[model samples]
Target: MTIATLPAYPPKPRPGDRVAVVSPSAGLPEVFPRPYELGLERLRRDFGVEVVEYPTTRKMAAPEERARDLNAAFGDPSVKAVISSIGGDDQITVLPYLDRELIRAHPKPFFGMSDNTNLLAYLWSTGIVGYHGGAVMTEFGRPGAMHPLTEASLRAALFTHGEHELRPADTYRDVDRDWADPAAFAGEPPMEPGSGWTWRNADRVAEGVSWGGNVEILSWLLMADREIAPDPSVYDGCVLFLETSEDMPSALDVFGILRAMGERGLLQRFSALLWGRPKAWSLESPNSAQEKVRYANDQRAAVLRAVEAYVPSIPVVLDVDFGHTDPQLVIPYGGRIRVDGPAGRVTVTY
Candidate 1:
């Protein structure tokens, strides 16, 4: 299907406005209450937004129930925004049950990332812009405190309009802590110095509505032939931003997926590409610091390998501080994004 017009940016919520917290994915709040509770406190205290929780926000529910809560949140006039508690593995199932017309009619800014990408894409198809970052359980519910950059970006996305410039975080981290342990709440996670962004073929500027999210989730969408446009020109001139999750697919797997996208003519459709900093460390694969560096490098290499075979001349930026990283920046999915390769800057319209 061809998207005839750009997606509309929903009205931003104010500090004291009510926002619905829903669990469209895994109900991690039920299993790990500490972080979830902390996140809620932060949302109320730090952000000063009144949070309304759905019935399935803390507990696992069937896809239909999740969809019902999402529809209710959107349909309510009092609720100014909707945010996910945390990302999970099966939000795609919830998509089939979503009332697209209801959500499209009651347009409000929606915030989520990782597996929540499914909803982002769905919202795009419905012609509403959605945020590609921030979650109550992760960003707002951070341990000691929220990262300064993250807070600033999210605050701007939530309450402000117009262009907000994107900058590289001075430091970043991907190592996860035991959310179940009380001791983990004592301080912030350890972070190392950042390497900044790596730009490739950045001789020109690319500006358009941003698209894409967690690469793994996008791969699933592609496999299901769900939200992607049948006509490649539908994405022409748009900025493509992608990031990986904690699952951390191998570099080869990353390349394989992008290769598949390239084969589908999706790669060449974008004006530029923004690669979020890969989450290098996870409990399942605890690599040494040196190993983590090597892993990231390999992933970047794989990305370039795919770019070379497809959209070789397009501008690409790597290691951007979004996705599953310490200090995440909110990208306005389906909203305007200006990537100035010459100036090494990125600005998003919220």
Candidate 2:
């Protein structure tokens, strides 16, 4: 199998740039108006970026229409960047309708996570690096103000280049404050203290191109054979970043996916694995602190089991901040990533 070589097209946006905000998935703006408004406001005030919207950006429209908006955003030269309001589950359906030539022609900075993973992978296929964080509603439109860590990471991702070191947030929040309640915007939420990252089987530092996204999403990509390279060697020595979503998939399910990747000759090709902090609890299943800790630990163990079984030599870093957790850090898909196991540090070159 031959690995797919990604094209290189840089899309850098400065403050005061015109950025388009689109909803490629569910239009939560229709349901939750407050956060949607707050998100738009912050994009203007905080980032000093003009927020543009398309017809389907805030509508529950057909998949083809959503694809059209995405293509239009990339096709327009004045649009310096494109961001998603939030992720939805059905973005996979929008894949076929997207115009690859249009996206490739413009190649602007695109930011999203979760279901937007579909678009990120698509952008990768077009050779443009896409950011995997900072949705308008979720990150920018947090009930309170945006998390400081989130803001800092977003700044680095949007404005800077070269290698940027990633630091775990000193504290974190996972509980969702009501968007409709105006009082929720009064202040930041209470946060629990957190320890730094946990390293596994550290030996040598490794640096390579980064890949992987929400693990469940990646499974869907694999099943669909979307943009993922068939040749495992294309991922040779690359860093693998994986995270779970709010759906709170079981540890067994997590392991099963990695096991399948191992079977596909993918697990052995990477030099390091960066696991995102697992979102153990959601509105649907609110686990206790102890339960959440146990769930995260169990999931980490499951990932370790798969690594040991398939690629024991690969360095593993657990609980780096990304995915559904609060104050999530943005990761550059298809960009360069460095993992220094000896120093217990990781950095990405955007």
Report lDDT (CA) for all predictions. Answer: 0.92, 0.86
Report the lDDT of model 1 for residue 246: 92
Write down the lDDT that model 1 would get.
0.92
Query: Candidates' TM-scores?
Result: 0.98, 0.96
What tens-digit string does per-residue lDDT give for candidate 1 at 114-194?
999999999998899999889987898888889999999999999999999999999998998888778988897888999
Which candidate number would show the highest TM-score if scored against the true structure? 1
Model 2 lDDT per residue over 1-350, tens place: 12346546376889989999999988888878778898999999999999999998777888999999998898889999999998989998999999987887788888999999888878877788889999999999986688888898888888778777889889877766777678877887778887678888777898887888999988998998887776667778888999999899999999999999999999888989999988888888899999998999899999999998999988888888888998799999878889998888899876
In candidate 2, position 192 carries an lDDT of 80
How far off is residue 61 in model 1, in Å? Answer: 0.9
- The stretch of ten residues in a row with the least summed lDDT in candidate 2 is 1-10
lDDT of 2 at 279: 87
Where in model 2 is the C-alpha error above 4 Å?
Answer: 1-4, 7-9
